[model samples]
Target: MPVREMKIDDLPQVLQIQKALAFQDWNERQFIAEITANYALCVVYVAAALHTPILGYAIFHLMGPDSELLSIATNDSHQRAGIGTALLNAGIAHLDFENGDKIFLEVREGNTKARRFYEKHGFEPYAERKKYYADGENAILYVKAT
Candidate 1:
């Protein structure tokens, strides 16, 4: 699988991928605004194939020096095929780790699959935010320290 930064033309595909994997309503306009405003380090991943639709994407926000993984989603059709891991690894590699020794992300408390994915990548549970999801689930904050 190949990973790269997302282009403007990739928004629709990205949206589709997000919808396929998302557990809540994520506004595309808000996502676009945040990404464009922080384009210096934020990115999205696309699996490579002949005219293949997007299988997954990851979004990150670099604040100060540390990176925050805003969201990561792999389409349901492509789940369990390592696409999510590939996207995450690619995003992690893109960070300026020499200056920032940590990456953080949040997953819903009930999202066992997502939590397991983060844990498999060496992320540790560090904190919790109550009612973080629109559906009223708390969120567990996971961090990977380099």
Candidate 2:
């Protein structure tokens, strides 16, 4: 897999992946804004073979010494193949290299798999937001010191 900065042309494939996943999906404009933002870091993981699909993407924002992982997702077909992990590790390393002091993200309270994945990467639960999702699910904030 080759992880690289997301390009404008990649939005359609990215949107398809987002639509297939059961999560808070961002609209095309939102993705465009993030990709163009001065403080944002957006990356995509592309499959190695010719004409292969994009496997995953990660979008984060860095402000001062704090970084927030806004979204990350792997295509359903590519899940559990380390694509998400690679994107996350690459994002964290990018943040650290940029002198970030801490990184934050929020996962749905019921997403045990995501929570466990963050925990495995040394993120600790810092807070919770009630009814953070449109579906009335709470959001668990997780933070990792860089």
Candidate 3:
């Protein structure tokens, strides 16, 4: 798992991974906003042997002591291969360095795999928002201390 701070040049590959696995479809503009935002920490997991193509990415927004895991996804071909976990660990390390107190995230109810993954990683689900998604899917909100 070779991880690094996401650079602007990585958006094309990141966007491709996002398109294949993201819960919320984010355009290039949104990705740019995160890359340029001072409060956001975006990290990418690259395959060193494959010319460093992005295998996954994680976006974390740090607001003082509070933070949010905005999005995280691994390319479909690389799913369940620890790419997601590597991205998550990288994001958590960055958040810790920034003195973040907690990390929050919301996952679609139907995304059981994601929900399970979060829970497995120590995130505790505290609430659920009905019809939180545009598709009327409920979103389970979870939080974990950094």
Candidate 4:
């Protein structure tokens, strides 16, 4: 998989893959619109396979001096194959963290698998917010210091 910053033209494909992997039903249009409108603050990655069009993507937002991971997902057909990790590495690489600080992100507390994935990448839970999701799930805040 070749990971790089996503072009505006890639939004549709990225949103489609993300919505399909979402555990809870949600509107992907909002995500697409936000990333499109906020490209200056967003960094996304697309994973292309040997014979496939695109397998998955990851998006992150840069706010002030901090980088926040917005979302990350792999196509169902490509899950557990390291595409997600590749996307994450690519997203982090795009950040202008010359100060060598930490990156942040929030994930559903019930998403044990995703939590473990972040932990494997050096993200540590530092806080939590209640009812952060449309489904009323709590969001666990994780940070990784580079």
- The CA lDDT of each predicted structure is 0.77, 0.87, 0.86, 0.72
User: What TM-score goes with each of the models?
Assistant: 0.86, 0.92, 0.92, 0.79
Q: Model 1, 14-121: lDDT tens per residue?
A: 777767665656677866676677554445555455376667777887765567888888878878899888888888777757753888888889999999999999
Clashing residue pairs in candidate 4 (N, C-alpha, C atoms within 3 angstroms): none
Looking at model 4, which ten-residue stretch has the lowest summed lDDT?
A: 40-49
Which residue pairs come into collision in candidate 1? none
Give model 1's TM-score versus the native structure.
Answer: 0.86
Model 3 scores worst on lDDT over the 10 consecutive residues at 92-101
Question: How high is the lDDT of residue 108 in model 1?
Answer: 89
User: How much is the lDDT of residue 101 in candidate 2?
Assistant: 86
Query: What tens-digit string does per-residue lDDT give for candidate 3 at 72-121?
Result: 88888888888889889888877764433888999998998888889889
Candidate 2, residue 29: Cα displacement in angstroms equals 0.8
**TM-score (C-alpha, index-matched) for candidate 4:** 0.79
In model 3, which runs have C-alpha deviations exceeding 4 angstroms?
97-100
Candidate 3 global lDDT:
0.86
lDDT of 2 by residue, 45-75 (tens): 9986846568899999977687899899998
lDDT of 2: 0.87
